[model samples]
Target: MTFDRKDKDNVTLLNFYLQLLYPRMVEEKMLILLRQGRIGKWFSGIGQEAIAVGSTMAMKSEEYILPMHRNLGVFTSRNVPLTRLMAQWQGKLSGFTKGRDRSFHFGTQEHKIIGMISHLGPQMALADGIALGDLIASKEKATLVFTGEGATSEGDFHEAINVAAVWNLPVIFLIENNGYGLSTPVNEQYKCKNLVDRAIGYGIEGLQVDGNNILAVYDLIDSVATRMRENPRPVLIECLTFRMRGHEEASGTKYVPHELLEEWAKKDPILNFEQYLLEQDILTPDAVAEIKANLKMEIEQEVEAAFNEPEPLAKEEEELKDMYFPYTSDPVSPEGPVKELRYLDAISDGLRIAMQKHTNLVLMGQDIAEYGGAFKITEGFVQEFGKARVRNTPICESAIVGAGLGLSINGFKAVVEMQFADFVSCGFNQIVNNLAKTHYRWGEKADVVVRMPTGAGTGAGPFHSQSNEAWFTKTPGLKVVYPAFPADAKGLLLAAIEDPNPVMYFEHKYLYRSLTGPVPEGFYTMEIGKANVLRQGQQLCIITYGLGVHWALDYLDENPDISATLVDLRSLQPWDKETVSAAVKNTGRALILHEDTLSCGFGAELAAWISEHCFKYLDAPVMRCASSDTAIPMNKALEDGFLAKSRLKHTLNQLLAY
Candidate 1:
């Protein structure tokens, strides 16, 4: 099956032709199905079959191939059952995503194919993650990822390429320059003469090939991949091709010039390759006709079989089942001796302990290696564990987060640290769209823990200081953990890393050095979704988390006769509802407090829930005290005034009096 010219015979060439022909015919049948309302939509790759077929066939089966919507040949070349593919396109139960996603949006773990998200550039970074796994495992395998010329304009493209170049990961970034991105031409896409030229800027090798020529693609990819297995490094390859069809069947090609269509139609990949096969006597005219007939018949039968397949049943339990992997909370034993540590030290120790426990755990972030991160959390980590385990990524938040998802796909627990919580905005799409939606979309576990250094009491300004926990708490498949004490910080972090779902561990920057407590010496895991009752009282309940817990404790310490119960919610996403409700009912009054802004904060949800469930037991209305709906100020006095702590005593006294 190797593409060696000296070993090439009629059989090899015929097999190549069959590989190319199957997708072309599938595209043809799929179009008819789309027109006949059999399927939802189509992203036709009519004129660019050679790129997908040749590049995919060039790699080994164990090496992963990440393909976009137009790269259907990647699936077909891997011999994915046509019936299942058709069922996928038709949104049937037998599809890879079980009707959760349509078209080539689903990936098959068995085939070692990672599918693309709609944001085309993220998958490129995802490939870097898989290649990183290969590099770490010392596996001689190269990961091939496909992108369009249009996606090259995305920041993720540059970020992924730059990271791969720096790490020397075995990844082949294949850009199929199909003349147009949807309707925008190459002129609008970039200023470079060729897409491959950008590789020089990244300090990586670049190559260009006629995408229509199947042999050229096969030869170049095979040689590059072979070299990469020995000396692992990324290479950029731009395959010059044209899109014969519109972006999708719904979008007509009227925007395209007729002359251009005619020109590309003459150089159709299938026809040109067929002619080459005919001239070489590898495929006679009768053989070509017979191959097409058989492929068309096979495709039609598969499509018909797909039509007979059952549609996904609208069952509530089944629909909700795969949102997250099954998890049980392990009791915190704290088996060994304990030692006092700061919040920062507890986080450091927790990560250190997790790294020791899970050999496959990887830490990725900016300035985390030699510099020990912005907060000095991972100061000596690179020295303890090598650079491979403690990776210092570029300031490409989007790409690095996507890489975490990639690493998780290959059975690695990834802990991605956001230097500051506010910086997460840069990688929002990867977090919410890719990581959070992964398990729900295809039942794939994303064992990634994103450490967000959050909160603002030291005048770090609006950008550096933000308690944005509510942003991800609303996201379905993500877990949000925010601990106030040092011990809880370490325990919750350990639990977050072990969780099967993507967990957002928000570490309060204000608490890093200011807070200290007795943290267990050895490894231990605290139960997520549980609240800690720091104090018990009968008059009122103070519900809070992170720095707010400190604020509540300070208020309670000064006012001894207040008789208020303090509840610190360790996890926000699955906040301890039972404990909060019970405390509120017991006290007959409630006050929700947080460091985040007042409007639409996590406090709002807590207030609403308390009102709904604890209405009968309430002695007073549920009150919320939070920061003003404005950006965190830089001046110390203004910041103190802006925070909820400024008015916490007054608010608590008012609630107690009520």
Candidate 2:
């Protein structure tokens, strides 16, 4: 159906006088700042204030709004103070981000406005996450995600919208089709006449509105917001308007036709709205002038205060650093707690206890809440902790994991679960960019735990079964851990939760049900980078971790004549090289074993380390025993036949032979 209704005099203005005049004056002030060199650059919401103001006005307080960078009008209208915003552009500590974010990266968390992701479409995913949060929290509020038509072409936008549609999330996607995405025209970017029609592919309805008319934008978006609360679905709305300014400063906008530019110049949003108000008799020229005068005075004062305000100070920076790190370090714990508990229970109880101890700690994965996770490791948390603390997230791995880093950086201790380790590739970006590098780049820690059910042997086949610890152990600043029994699981998890860095804490799915061991009921601690000397002997040092420790210890027990020191490298990075080095130095002979494939496995690295540092002390060349680089077969016997366990058995016999 053709939605060609364009009612010029129909736009409504409902801002408290302070809020109303503030936006127009701020936009003008920004223009002045750009000319005065007080700010870096400016992107004005000059001709689009109607859409920005009205749509934001239509939203509920609890409802989320993910505004595009151009929504300066909406920001001002919704209580994003002008002085702080000016400081944001000025790169001052008085900025809304306290001097961290970019100039346009404005946010008003108190107003339920999530910060925008500037690369265009990342905010789509964030908006979906906000909706997911609403659903999980059982809040009736919906999410309003704003973007330009240019963002519609981004792959992430499609991915986010598709997922939202499939899940029937309470989300409204608003596209400010302001004729251009900088130099590129909206029509040039996509073949479609309307950006909203793209939602049809994802099984969601689309609507188009005359963005120049504020009432059209307001009433349409408001109805969509209401529909979301009632039916809980994702919808896309295209707002057709013209952008009056160059994309960011006065640069690279030479592409628009002179005729079109002149035509748009005649239809400026504020002036047209003023004329419409005059015609409706709702406002007079004198009243408008008075409003502008009051706004100008208020803005002048706020901007002066913002510019004159002192820096956030060392203490505030220190506090922001802590906000970015959910976990608290324990003076590098004096003792590793491996001796006190079993493996599986170690991780489960460690996480449980950490959640109890840290109010900011939140957990999520498939069936993790009520089911205590698929392994029953987190089984009782829902009852004891409530869904808010221990929640079951939808099976959207990428979206779920991506938010973990963002949430953790924003003061929540997030533990995102990839139900099976093999499926981690689905959320690889979250693990790599969001978690590992975010800390090292900005000198801020993203204290998030990515828990995955790893390893094999339940006949789950290649898809469900994997021992891929080696792949991630290679990444710097990402602490990796795997536990064999209940105690180590709990201990290592406790250490992981408290680490001021990202941790890839993997639990063996096979061992979760059967690997129970005694864990003390009381809360305890463990050192993250230290490994335990499970069994010490004089002949050789066998460095291993995860369930491999179990088989090695058992083998040593049976053959006391084959004396060896077993070291569990609990933390993969900053691994207890001291412990391993000492054991190798004393024993003279060394061997490294693991469950992952032979090629470049963690065992290979250990062997390389021994060869480099302990070559002189070695009784023989360092050896590595690992599984073949083939998919774990469905047949149990064949899988075991191809495993590192058999090679480990052979190595033991050979060491004895020597």
Candidate 3:
């Protein structure tokens, strides 16, 4: 419904009350359920209901809102079915996340709500991405993201706001400053006088309002949203409110002062709004009582119905479903002549081809636009696709990664480039928790590719040079691809972009310019999870990927008499188990090699799998050749010693002899 300041008819007033009171009643009932051990937990938005209700009511239905756990009014204001919402809270199959998540933790696309992650700050960046999508589509839409004052202290908050301000995206950073983060007081949270003051640092419009006053919040947000749709820029709004209840019912308010509680109680948002309505002759005492009574009854019935609903059943096959969108590869055979390209050029060519093929594809990274990225992979991307598609982002890895996820949510294929593979550690949370789990938790496809320029050998030092693919290989729902040659680099990159799942494409820095091979002129894709056998033999099987593939090739080239099978496991996560097992069984010896540390490396998984599946055919124990458990040193001599190529050749010889 349209919010009008001058036209506050009885019907409008009553609807607003319903919007405000419904959540109040629902929260009260939820608390009761929590006390009765009916539901798992409740994050009560006891006194600060107006911020959610007012903000949600002010926005257009087409616009999006990312609400925190405490903003239950946003859900009620959007008119989400109470039965289904309660079912969600009860961990039933009818819930939005299919019982994969609880509370307001899951987002409903139909309601235009993007769910907030437990890591509260990342949603801010996600909001930036959604806004970016809207802006790109030329849709006059704005996105509102809610965060507490405590969450603003996170690096994601700064990164998201900075990115939003720089891009001038239509995003409203709503800070529900409810006095405390769990038990910590606001005085200790930040040194600034007001949360709104920090907005000036980002050069964005900042405002503060009496959050407990429903009318004031509604009027301000309504006006702000109207302006944002037209102007399309970031704004930071700090809602001054209080949390009357504990962080959760179980976390008691013993740490909160009795005096403070009394003070906030006097400023209860619902009571104050009711008083305002009464003075305006809009809602009488009886009317208020009647509205609350009806809402309470409605909430009770819905909660009861939800409680009676069947809980999510655990089936082995069902549990494994929806981790990723079904992907089928249609192999493209080159009809024309192929040309030789460097690994870096091949990746660049693949990116260009994908961008040309998919109009909705976007590339984001630090210095990717004008500076051509740290490694110059995207040197001419900005010129080719313009800044909108090939956007340069701040050095905030976490936020940009989250923004990529947000873009994917809005039907955009996003490819985020980490300047170096080691730098992925900064964006680790977004990759592993948000991107990796988005599909499994809520059946949302995270069609994003994170390009990681990896490996050591250039004396790039510990941080820049790392074979950290194992970190994500172990994480469920993430596809890790490490291509050894230039052709595989291009083909796998295109394949990764096309996959409807988050794919980590690892590019070895040493192979970028040093490796050259024939790549098809036109677009082509290599199958992920499938291994390519470079050589065929019968005495021994060598399973490896990335730099190890080259090492094994060189070793085999020198020792031609030693009959061996060299298998290039192009994909680590869904490694070519079929090919590796067959090769191992045929050869009767298995040797795994990698650039990562020997202990707990991806090779270890291969070794264990080979031992388990190929045990009967094994002529000797499965051997592994990898780096020692130490950081890659900057000194060339030290790095060479760390890689231990001599050890790799010796290990292969030992396995073949056995």
Candidate 4:
């Protein structure tokens, strides 16, 4: 590789020199910290500093930057203070995340930079959402996202890139092809001639650059930045570089040939940049030495100060505040007699009322724009809210949810609709791993709601009709809510919009029109994590939610002889344990029911809890009734038999007989 001899002024030359020195100084100090047992682990960007520094330097100050763990140069270039970085690595309270997470896993609203999670591929998809939100607002800004060659193998990588392409989001996908994914070589990870070539299929521009040449990398990105800002198009730029160090401190490169490592070390990004500056007479030899010495001193002082700071104390009560949804109530409620409304109409009214009240609320889903969603729940929403707020996304479930997460982090609450509740499996990675873990991992707020159209009655078959609430209930860091009435449905949807955490709001498809009742006309919020007692009784307790709530109510109404207290467990995760336990202890018997499958369902957890806590109070074994352990068939007869009302009636009769 050769350098282009051109003077782009003193400011540019000076910044290039500093970028080269910053990462080199930090990585060397990181090795010392590891030896002293001050930091736990380190992933050095040693030979690839140029790619991080060069690409980021081209971005505007306000443009969002999403970087993976290895991009140390990008962090420093973005003006992330050395003290905060040092404190974070040392696990001190003065760190960015207040010691919630260790190293590079922290973000701040002020900097407009989202700290990278361990999942490298998903961040690319998230960047698309952030960029999409900006595009919707007509903001002239671009998003810069970084990943490695190995991450391209992940499903999220393709999903995000495809969405960006289809939507023409102003996002720059920078792939740092560092030759290897930990111990595995590039050949084993991808079969393409070059990673950038894959952009041909995405209908985006592609380019490959010599990542070791800082000047060339900067020039290529700088030329495209202005164009991307104007047109807002997704572009792929592949930087060919190598990680001179092992994956982490302890992970030795035994799999890499010694000759290969030696060859790459000779072309180190920082060392090459330094030589270029010297040969071009941009700086004298003494000036180069002085810059390195000053950077080292600054880094050492930062480490010393950060190590002296006190570590953050974890208060159980205070920390628990961030664990679940904070307590809040609705201000707008009906003063006069409430009007009767259909359950589906109530949901639409709730969305309209919330959108009118809160400016930060936005809705995204497939066919949600002109089509108003699959069931017309959002009919005419586009005309009322405009295309910007009411977005029709591509058929990418993972991208839809992942982008919603990005919007949440950026101070906007996203109401994401899964076309079918069962289709959420396509974006399972974002739902369970990313959305559920963001708050717990770094104490960052994920204020987003995933609206699931769940349950069966329309004979939509296995793929469309499924009660997947059990899947989310089993995962931590999520609030699951299922409303059986129009009033609760409207109130809870409003409450979820105002929540500061992620919520899984399951709207049963069957109850959308069949179950109608008097609903408040104005904005109101039902308290989350509480159960509603529909009917009080002394014979037994029926713990149910969603469609099961209706079944339990219908059975008791018809069989007037059996008297039982029906508890609607609206909140499945942090369920109203106090209410259910008290009701069960009073009745001396319990029957847990749900629309989900019988085996390994959420009801199993409830049954176990009742047995453990209300054990002595039990008059008979705590029984659980749910849909048969089979896929919901397309035939109405088969589906009804699968979750038959008669079967539920028989289960209640048997429990009453016991």
Top-lDDT structure, candidate number:
1
Q: Would you list the clashing residue pairs of candidate 1?
A: none
* lDDT for each residue of candidate 3 in 1-658, tens digit (9 for 90 to 100): 1233466777887677778888888887877778788777888999999899999999998889999999988988898999999888778899888888888778888898988888889989999889999999889988999999999999999999999999999999999999999999999999999999999999999999988877788888888889999999999999999888989888989999999999999898877767777777888888777877887788788878888988778886866667777778776765577999999999999999999999999999989999998889999889889999999888899989999999998889999999999999999999999999888777888999999999998998899999999999999889999999998999999999989899999999999999999988888888999999999998888899999999989988888898989999999978888999899889999888899999999988999988888899999999999998998899998999899475887897787667
lDDT of 1 by residue, 1-658 (tens): 1133456778888888899989999898888888888777899999999999999999999889999999989999999999999888778888888888887887778999999889889999889999999899899999999999999999999999999999999999999999998989899889989989999999999999989888889999999999999999999999999999999988878889999999988888788777777877787889878878988888889889999988788888877767787777786678878999999999999999999999999999999999999989999999999999999998999989989999988878899999899999999999999988887777788899999999998898999999899999999888999989999999999999989789999999888898889988998889999999999999999999999998888877887888888999999988888999899889999999999999999999999999998899999999999998999999999999999998787887788777
Q: How high is each candidate's TM-score?
A: 0.98, 0.72, 0.98, 0.94
Select the stronger candidate by lDDT from 1 and 4.
1
Q: Assess each prediction's global lDDT (C-alpha) against the native.
A: 0.91, 0.73, 0.89, 0.86
Clashing residue pairs for model 3 = none
Better of 3 and 4 by lDDT: 3
lDDT string for model 2 (186-292, tens) is: 66899977777787898999899878666566778878888789788999888888887788877745887889878876766566656656666767889888878
Candidate 4 C-alpha lDDT tens digits along 320-435? 66665454654455555698888899999999988898777889999998999998999999999888788898888998899998888766789999989999999888888878
Q: In model 1, how many backbone clashes occur?
A: 0
- Angstrom error of the Cα, residue 512, model 2: value is 5.3
Superposed model 3: Cα runs more than 4 Å off = 1-5
Q: Give the TM-score of candidate 4.
A: 0.94
Reference-based TM-score, model 2: 0.72
